[model samples]
Target: MTAPFPPSRPSPTTLIGGHVLVAGGLATGGLKYAADIEAEVVQVFVTNPRGWALTDGKPSEDTALRESPLPVFIHTPYLVNVGSPNAEVLEKSLGSIRHALRRGVEVGALGVVVHTGSSVTQSREDALRQIHDHLLPVLDEIPDDGPDLLLEPMAGQANMLCATVQDLGPYLETLEFHPRANVCLDTCHAFAAGHDLAAPGGVKAMMDALHAIAPGRLKLLHANDSKDPCGSGRDRHENIGAGLIGAAAFGELLGHPAAAGIPLCIETPGKVEGHRNDILLLKRLRDELA
Candidate 1:
């Protein structure tokens, strides 16, 4: 163990990470499964792995999970496309959002993460309208104790509206989502989407942009590296500091003015050793760069 936490005063939380406990993808018991497999905390999909209709999970099941100091998070199903223009897709998307919020409560999760999907060639105004119309209502249904939602912008690919974090600005502004409606910036997605967070001022620029939109709404970070060039619009996630985005970028990310104390989650390849290596690397950066 990393020595009983060293008993220091808790610092103010920000975008950077501090001893992150990456949640494993749901292959079995969802969050409980990850918890059992040596996860400090975990994130899981509470539904049919690849379906629109979310499965109704029981709350008592979450109550029976193994005890730990780590907090759990829920990742909404990938089938949800909140930015879709088709009526059927739109309805399903909205329903999926509601289901994710509700399921998050059942599992005693900290929050749920939703991808800021594209508008599918629909007018930009209409796309924004759809988000304001369908998404905000789900946020309203959530009670104070319910798990809040975290909006994640995807890599900007052809036909996708939200390819960068900046693309989510309008959606965030239009929604009545809880104050906890935070951002989850994926390193690979952000880098591939456009923002180069590896240069000297790159991290500063990213922090500035993130702060400009939500101020303090950045909740979690999908700590990953990219395999393509900057602005490639590819979503390939490589091991930390090993791909297109160099190690210095992470140094900037882990040691940024804005990124100081957030739960940096790892969604990289491999399970035990992959996560272990990344976590140790991040910890080393925090120590050397912080």
Candidate 2:
């Protein structure tokens, strides 16, 4: 029998989880993977993350996830770039997102994460316009009960349309501040984008900035450590506590008021064992504060 689902809204306490690769499928392998890691929440890709091929979930797997006690989330394929200048790339990106959203609803996901894309070969203004024109209709079509569209800002890579927490202001305004358009702050990305999460009171300061810029829109957090230095613009992720963003900073992150009810999912390295250790550390940090 499937387990009961978690609460629809944010919980009073934070939930910790990792991105589970369901190579054996959600019901058969994914659920077991989550259990192995002792995850309180879960994130999965509904299709090939690096490819444009759209695949459907198994009915059994869908039902199992829909009823699972853990709150579920979907990370749209990496190929999705709604801000692309090329028409074909743009079309495929939108199609991939729509598919992810539909599958997210099928699996009772609470949020769907998509990267804030870059403005390749075009001015940032033109790219934002493209995103506004094409992506708004897609956002409008989401059902009331469907998962939220969580826009994760990128590391401050060259030409990225959205990198820092402040960049979200313009992006959301371009979307006319749609109710479904929410934020998913990634620690590694934020640090790489120059948030200085490793410094004293850095996490709290970043959280304060986020709340000021986009109040009540932070629905998810990607707790990751950077393999590169601050402001490096690199996206390489290292295992928790082993990289630049140190374990202490994560404790601060857990204690931040703005992060109290948010669910944090690690996208760090070291598969199952690494994820298990990371989750345990985060839980310990959270418990100590509690």
Candidate 3:
């Protein structure tokens, strides 16, 4: 189906991708899936996404990923909530991030992306303090060659720390403006947070805000179409051109300077076939709009 909004003037510089599942119980299944969809970049979980357990990747799997030409990214497990109040959960969250960083190195990943989790039961102030106290040491220990720690802003569900572009300030400050810190802006999350990416000049305005916050820190884009409307605060993701944000918004995003030369991975529904089609659809929008 054609997108509801006007097709954006596209650019040939963007490299779109998908959140490929590690199919067939193979850690390299994500790479295979990316290849199947002709994706230039790929994102995957180095271990079970829902659990805290960190997998010791096999030599063969590590070797295969290193040999691949794709720009791979490792997403820290969902169980990580670095802002959690509970001591145990907080410790695990910190450990999980460190583990993801180490794993990213082993797999030759470009970055390790983690959500800016909510500050449940704590004020934003307190959460920022905790994040600083715990994560500062970890960031200090990062080698000069370690993959960047990219923060993915979430939909402004209650207590979300980095809901808008301006909200990233405290986190950046807390990291003492660490050079390795970067952003992974998600279209659906920004739309859900009421950024209006589908509206005229909306993408530019959003980029302006991000530029004001931290120039050149937008290292990745989660190119999702929100199933929910602007300001709905829902995290539902829909396929390309098939949701509230529409395909044109994605094209708009691709056209923005902030998105050039980075991986735009769709975290939409469906696996292999769905992701394959979505990748093709994005590429079509990019080329046709250009």
Candidate 4:
């Protein structure tokens, strides 16, 4: 189905923002929260991030976000695991994705971020086949004007379907590389998955690998620092400069050609002040590189 409202594509510049809290609603609270952090782009969850229940967001809040100048993206619930071996889990995952996509159109969101899930108790081949069977139809239903389904590879956790940039090759292949099948590169996840973004040239190498794996598929970035060491397989997030990924790596990320024009949204720790500082630091890095 065609998206009733197609979001405008973001310009070719590094737009920095954070995942703003929406406890106060998107308009009454979320927009102000983003403003206080001076966010240039925004990521939000239309429904509870951890719950399976879908919500019809307040019309005023939806309208507020749709009309707002900043680019918007929606992150699906953490429970969504399309690659799961359980039938009930797979069904719920697909439903959640559809809900997020619908809400993305309602809010003029550019993309809907969904984690590349695990394949618990099943072989990798079986999980991929299941994903292809279920996910392809969802992708096929998304209209050209609808939000892109941005698959976020996780930290190198056990049984993860996609973690490294190279892994995205098969994952995208499973989805047939649909136009709307894009990627969201999270720095901490990449570091945990053993990309070593903190090392010299590491960020560039990762970007190069992504380009080689799925050219032009990167649509969003989660600019975060890893609380654990590279290859730790931990998903802990830290303030930009305070973690293992470090601030300099972000500078390299901003300078990289592949990252240009993509919106960078911080999922780092600390609510307001921490996010504000992270955004400022990234902006500084982006400016210095420019």
Write the residue-wise lDDT of candidate 3 on 1-290 in tens digits.
Answer: 21232343335747888777777633568677888877888888888889888778887888788778888888888888888888899998988899989988888888889998888898888989998888888888778778999998889999888887878878899888888889999888999998998788888889778877788788888988888999899889999889988888877777766666667888889877888899998888777655
**Every candidate's lDDT:** 0.69, 0.90, 0.83, 0.90
Best of the two (1, 3) by lDDT: 3
TM-score for candidate 1, please give it. 0.84
- Model 4 residue 200 lDDT score: 90
Candidate 1 Cα deviation (angstroms), residue 42 = 2.2
* Model 4 superposed RMSD (Cα): 5.2
TM-scores of all models? 0.84, 0.95, 0.93, 0.95
Error of 4 at 202 (Å): 0.7
Across 48-140, the per-residue lDDT of candidate 2 in tens digits comes to: 889999998889989999999999999998988988899999999999999999998899999999999999899999999999999899899
Clash pairs for candidate 1: 16-259, 16-260, 156-163
- Cα misplacement distance, residue 224 of candidate 4 (Å): 0.4
Candidate 2 residues lying further than 4 Å off, grouped into runs, are: 1-12
- Superposed by TM-score, candidate 2 places the C-alpha of residue 18 at a distance from the truth, in angstroms, of 0.6
Number of clashes found in candidate 4: 0
- Pairs with backbone N, CA or C atoms under 3 Å apart (clashes), candidate 4: none
TM-score of the candidate numbered 2?
0.95
Clashes of each: 3, 0, 1, 0
